[model samples]
Target: MVASTHRDRPIGVFDSGVGGLTVLHELLVQLPQEDFVYLADTARFPYGERSQAELQEFSLQIAEELIRRQVKLLVVACNSATAAALPLLQERMMRTTLGVDVIGVVRPGAVHAVAATRTGRVGLLATTATVESGAYAEAIAAADPHVDLVQVPCPDLTEIIEGGFPFDQRVVDTVRRYCAPLREARVDTVVLGCTHYPLVRPMLQRMLGPGVTIISSGAPLARQVEHVLGSRSLQAGRTEGEGTYSFLCTGDPEPFRTMGTRFLQMPLGEVAQVDVAGGALAGGGPALA
Candidate 1:
């Protein structure tokens, strides 16, 4: 075993549930030498329907949990959480002694969509909270002021995908319904604004047709992670073999392990349980119910 250093500390990532694993899959492939610690706040899963206040509280709780584990950087892989809490999370991290860098999914996906679109018309399919947050709109506008973004709030899509994805008729119907407006808009690029959406990428592509480019946060977010690690000189030093990863969840570890292995599409070796009950997180601000 090599001696541990500040650079060897694992990157921290959190999501409401297993959806974030899609982002993790990209990171594992892009930065094979870096270790990661991913936390699933399954106790507060399906952030899509939650209010901004609730999502922010949940995000802060999860951030404190990951920080306790000595993470060198932080990644918020859930769109709803990012929409509600990215700025707050970044501020909290900045106050930490380590000042861990924080990155989120929405902006990266928006930037990629702007770059990929030929018609300057981008489509977004995400949860209700994410759509309402206006994060994607701001990000796309910042990337290119001339770009037009068509947003569809898929209130039930995240839950459908999170339920697991052999993708039944209901899932197909839901996806088709969501894709209709984008197809009508004739967007040249469609952004999978929610991490869970990537798992059903094939269906999305089939529905959107071959002429449209599909963008997901995984690839672009992975690139951003690489850039952050390089700029901070925090890249892991393990050169000969791939690095290790571990899991934490506020809900049952068994289900997270089972669904996570499928979502992650990789060996989910072990999953530990974490409790962020009110009394446990003083720094997270009076705990959330």
Candidate 2:
């Protein structure tokens, strides 16, 4: 019999905004027995424009906060953060006794895109920061050097998905405009480099056409999370009840909760407003275990 460990601790997930909720959605589906704690740095939304040093600092602060909360795993669900700060975050975590695994969205998406592409022509739709970071390009090359990657950096896609209500024509037009280059490239596979892209996946799929396979981070990352937990014997053993989840945002909680439910497609319970350092929690009631 295995002694009880950190198995019951919630898995921590964070993004620049509600975009990482897309990753949480996959984790909830793939590992429903485990609970989750999600943090959104909405006050600093659109982290795509932030500098590498800032991203590293922000990622470290968030990681320390999650570690304080006793999270068993940390998932960097933001592409910009993953591209810029994953190494620093992981290195910092290595100093801790728990040393939680840090998984990012870039390599998994790249590997999936590479495996999915048949024609050797792949397209990437991402924020300007992610494209500029060149992380995906390197990952795709490491996975398969022969595959050609056409990357398009969209300026307004994340903001549109975050703020645009009712999914208006502007959102469609923006998505269409981004997909135009991918369409012109006639790519066999497209990678949604940003976590927020999943929310508009249907629209992206339609824009990219039915034949082109689209890959996102959530599903692939979810599988990796599961594997990490299982290999380390950190998986929750509960078999009778559904795992609970809650929200912590650096900005207003109401908007985070409201906008987040749409992204996660699940009920978002209590949301507390938190500071960048992760202390000074305000508002929201306790989440059920």
Please write out the lDDT profile of model 2 over residues 1-289, one tens digit for every residue.
Answer: 3345688889999999999999999999999999899999998889877888778777877777787788888999999999998886786676576677799999999999999999999999998889999999999999999999999999789998999468998998999999999899999899999999988899999888899999998999999999998888888979887898988998889888888888899999899888766321111112212
Over 4 Å off, model 2: 1-3, 278-289
lDDT tens digits, residues 38-152, model 1? Answer: 9999987889999998888888878877777888889999999999999988987777766788999999999999989998999999999999999999999999999999999
Mark the 10 consecutive residues where model 2 has the least summed lDDT.
280-289
In model 1, where do residues sit more than 4 Å from their true spots? 1-4, 279-289
Flag clash pairs in model 2: none
Best by lDDT: 1
lDDT for position 62 in model 1: 81
